[model samples]
Target: MGLENVWVATLTDGLIRADYIAGIETHQTPALTGKPSRWLLDVTLTVSAGSGTKDSWEVSHLHRTLAQTDVYPAQAAEELARRLHRLRRDGAAGVLRTYVRYEELSFEFSYFDAGEAAE
Candidate 1:
């Protein structure tokens, strides 16, 4: 595991970086000391326990990874967000839809809502 564990950068401090969301220009500057020169979503998929709300949706920045990473810190954060949501709704079956098929899904995920509207 010599080169495997070498962390070249820290993409995000938390699960979601609101600023670097799915739309409207994701974060340009990746934590860049450690891009694997490929698309392997650096961060491990840890679906944060919980779900959505009114003021906004507890959505993950996953969609962006498809392009951003290709153009993509964004790796893990994005993946984690998508995986969490699916797990919350679909369970292990969902996570398998993309990555890590049939891995014991963590029950940390619970609920989500659309958020209170504004006038």
Candidate 2:
């Protein structure tokens, strides 16, 4: 964990920011504040499970051109996929699945809604 180690999660209003930062060098630090409430899921998950259960996740979300192609609309991607299906029914989703493939020690984080699903 030493390639100038960086597994950062410094989001503001989208949660996950209680001074929680991994190895420094926060991508040229200049964010002086916080204001994010939605624009959910720019995710990329890949895990080809062997013992089964994860159902082999293969999600993708990347857009760096065409003005970011509407920047992930569609009701915030179905409300972040219904808050990731309520964190897979409150079992604490296995930290959002990842296999042994380390693409630069891949990192991304967010799941801030343990409410609004009581019906």
lDDT of 1 by residue, 62-94 (tens): 432222244333344445465444443432211
Alpha-carbon lDDT, every model: 0.32, 0.28
Tens-digit per-residue lDDT, 1-119, candidate 2: 11111121323222221112121211112334583232222332222223334766553332111011212343433443443445445533222211112211222233334453322
lDDT of candidate model 2 versus the reference: 0.28
How large is the C-alpha RMSD of every model relative to the true structure? 17.0, 17.8
Question: Candidate 1: lDDT over CA atoms?
Answer: 0.32
Q: Which 10-residue window in model 1 sums to the lowest lDDT?
A: 1-10
Candidate 1 regions exceeding 4 Å error are: 1-40, 45-70, 73-76, 94-119
RMSD over all Cα atoms, model 1: 17.0
